[model samples]
Target: MSATRPTLKLTHSGALQALDGALRKAEELGVPQNITVVDEGGNLLAYVRMDGAKLLSRETSMSKAITASSHRQPTSRLDPRNEIKLAIAGGGRLTNLEGGLPIIIDGHCVGAIGVGSGTGEQDVEVARAGLAAIGAEDQKP
Candidate 1:
């Protein structure tokens, strides 16, 4: 094996694009939201707390993004049996909420988007909009 391999990454611009898309969807749904974007390594790239969004949900949005990036999948798909355990193990960084979605492109997870301050289904819908803005693959039902 080679000592190095090429890797796909989500650029800052892309992260902002995702954020914008999520924002638009939230507006259309008439639900304010706290949105976050994180790289594949779970590093925050972009974030926004929409006006009137729940202030407490800002933290949850970041947690969701980090969880999705770390797990390389939608946060909603995480094992529910391990929800509490995972949270404790992750020191609250990981969550099983339905607002986190991985940004997958060319079979690689580039990053993730997380949204909060709405119903779980609405949050997921916003996250999906973000993924779509960047041409990332949506999670299967």
Candidate 2:
């Protein structure tokens, strides 16, 4: 077997499915938001921001998703235990509030999705739902 390099890549179908799920759920939750998907290597896969989403949420969502994948942990977990420089908590550092969720499949983390502009809990919910939309919960890096 050859050594495998970690990476994050988005597929057209997967992106559309995640976007659709997140958009629908977010509208139902009544929050205009920015949703981001990044692969395990902290690479951008897909990004969508509904009208009225704060400009800050765009970068924030991306950071959260990327962080989740890079660290193979939820943004919330990293937010508290400051072991990685990318871990954000106070002013600056992606907020680390919540919403970033890891995309795990086959016992491996392949990517992550982040939802912004709603409560932290809502962000996490919608992000999880989005991953479920495409059956990405078991994806691996």
Candidate 3:
């Protein structure tokens, strides 16, 4: 077996594009948001805290992005029963919130986007917009 394998990575420009899309969506919804983007390894790529967004949500948004990237799935899909455990295990870096979405491209998860400072549904909607902007697959229903 080969020791090295090819992997898709999220570019800084792509991360910025996703952030812009999420910001536009938040503006359209009249909800300022704290948005974050992270690479597949859960390393931060981009972030934005829109004017009027909840200051405390900045950390939550990053947590959501990191959780999505690490889990390779939407944060909303995580087992609620294990929410506390997951958070503890991640040292508060993981969350079971609805704002996080994995950025899937060509069947691979490249990264993730997360939005906070809005209702769960609204946050997901914004994140979906980000995925759309980057031509990534949105979370399945």
Candidate 4:
């Protein structure tokens, strides 16, 4: 067998840049946000809960990242009804709240980012800033 199969993955350096960018945006919006990053397989890669961010948002942020990375779509597109089904059906946990985004590069999904602890719109804005940091915003589906 071959030593390995070709696949796209997010680098820690890239994740850090994204995180920094998101945090900066959150500061601009006066929001202390929780941010999460996950691999395409929905595995947690990086995360941060900014000072003053709600402790409850930690799980939600990870859930959003998992939902987006595994489903290859933003959590905003997930309907309420399907949320239950997706979880029960072993599709993995999901959240309907916005701010979750898939990270795409060169036409392939590398991972995802999720932001919480703010209004849905503010979360999304911060998440987009993260994507922009790695030049992945325009690549998103």
The Cα local distance difference test for each model comes to 0.93, 0.75, 0.93, 0.85
Candidate 4 clashing pairs?
A: none
Q: Could you list the CA RMSD of all candidates, in the order they appear?
A: 0.8, 4.1, 0.8, 2.5
Residues 12-126, model 1: lDDT tens digits: 9999999999999999999999999999998999999999999999999999999999999889888899999999999989999889999999999998998999999999999
Candidate 1 — which residues are off by over 4 angstroms? none
Candidate 4 stretches with Cα past 4 Å from truth are 1-5, 90-92, 138-141
Model 2 Cα lDDT, one tens digit per residue, 16-116: 78878988888888888899987767677788999998888887798778777766767777544554444423234444568888877766787788788
Least accurate 10 contiguous residues by lDDT in model 3 = 132-141
TM-score of each predicted structure versus truth: 0.97, 0.80, 0.97, 0.89
lDDT of 2 at 72: 72
Per-residue lDDT of candidate 4, residues 38-139 (tens digit): 888888778999999999899888888888887778888877778788777755567777889999888788999999999898888999999999988443
What's the CA error at residue 39 for candidate 3, in Å?
0.2
lDDT minimum window of 10 residues, candidate 4: 132-141
Model 2: pairs clashing at backbone N, Cα or C within 3 Å: 8-39, 104-137, 104-138, 104-139, 105-138, 105-139, 106-138, 108-140
How far off is residue 118 in model 3, in Å? 0.4
Candidate 2 Cα lDDT to native:
0.75
